[model samples]
Target: MASTHYTPAQLALHWLSAAFIIWALVMGFSVMLLDVTPTFKATIAGVNVSLSILFIPVFAVRTWLRLRHLRDHGHRPGERLAGVIHNVIYAVTALVLVTGVLMMDRPIQVFGWVTLPQPITDPVWDHRFHTLHAGCNGLLGMLVALHVLAVVKHEVVGKPVLRRMWVAR
Candidate 1:
């Protein structure tokens, strides 16, 4: 019988990305909600920014792998909707990363190890990018929720969707 599971590398990337994204999202929200010092807030923001930057390549590889899977295996039942969701997730994620970089006023020091040059210098443009970043994050949040709900629904209904993604063999 043909294998119905993703490769271990794919599963590793999927879980790693999920963990990083969740951490970034939680830190992003915590910075907004907590009454923290500017230094602390900057620290949180720095970590979030670094994670976002790091995620770019990971997302790219994941997308390629997903597309390859689709081409090789063809779409399973109800997978068209999943494909749409995955594409939207990628688009919004890329938008968020771009806007995030543009929203900064100075070079981003990733964990103080490396620095990324600021893309936008004007305050107006930075503000605009910030708005777009926040909006895209909100949309990402909803999409993630839907994705999780669908997974849960499948699991509840005895589908092995999650297993296909989570298990290697």
Candidate 2:
């Protein structure tokens, strides 16, 4: 019989990833599209850059856990499409992270503790990477919306999908 609940580590990673991704998406779009003050925009950019840098390792660990779990447990029945969609989400997330690093026009400062020089120096190439990063990030946002909708649908149909992922008392 298949276990109904995700492991504790899995639950933690999932919630952490969800919160960060949603926050990033909202802040990113707001900074790009809103008429915010330059100072405010810069502050948000600095914080987001630092967070993204720190998140890289967390994402790597999450990916490793996901792959290991899949190998150990295999896929459940009728989950092939969901698996494919999830893989696409992961791939787009990887692109977003890589392009974020590649597009840096300024030094990456992680919460003022560490500073790494920009990865791409050429203006033209850096702009291109930025464009790609924005596109990939948008795709990730859409995929996340779909994932949430699927969970809601499952809940409505009495599957208790959210319960499976919720922290146990």
Candidate 3:
């Protein structure tokens, strides 16, 4: 039998991670496009780093739960494509986060609460990782658009698939 809904914990993590990813993307573009001071840009970078770091464990847990659910309930019709898209999203997200961390030239401070030391300090590698981070984010943006469109398509066709990920009533 296929499960009709995700557990509340899964839904919570899904929505929370989605929100954070959106925010980070927006902030990332803002920093790149706006003529902000170095101080302000650093602040935004800190927030992005902090949020990306936080998302690591969230994604791990969500993946584990999703695998468990799939194991227990089996796949539903049309789920193969959905699963591939989801796995791509996971991979792109991890790539973005990993490259973001690797691109950092200094310690990352989490909203002034905690500080993390840089894992690498080589300028050449940092530049390379920065490029990779930007490229991955571009890919992530497309994947996210596809994801949202798929949900909308499902809804328009009367599937109402969003309810499975939405908070339970």
RMSD of each: 2.1, 1.3, 1.6
Instruction: Please give each candidate's TM-score.
Output: 0.89, 0.95, 0.91
Model 3, residue 26: C-alpha shift (Å): 1.5
Model 2 lDDT per residue over 87-150, tens place: 8998898899899999999889999999999987999999999999999988998999999999
Model 3: weakest 10-residue lDDT segment is: 160-169
Query: Candidate 3 at residue 58, lDDT?
Result: 89
In candidate 1, position 26 carries an lDDT of 75
TM-score quality measure for candidate 3 = 0.91
Off by over 4 Å in 2: 1-4
lDDT per residue, candidate 1, 1-169, as tens digits? 3336688878988899788877887788888988889999988887788877888789889879877877787666657787788888878877887888889988887777889888878999999999999999889888888888999998999986876776534
lDDT of each: 0.82, 0.88, 0.86
**Residue 152 shift from truth in candidate 1, angstroms:** 1.0
- Angstrom error of the Cα, residue 100, model 3: value is 1.1
lDDT of 3 by residue, 20-92 (tens): 8888888888999899999999888877888888788888898798789878986776687888888889889
Which candidate do you rate higher for TM-score, 1 or 3?
Answer: 3
Clash-forming residue pairs, model 3: none
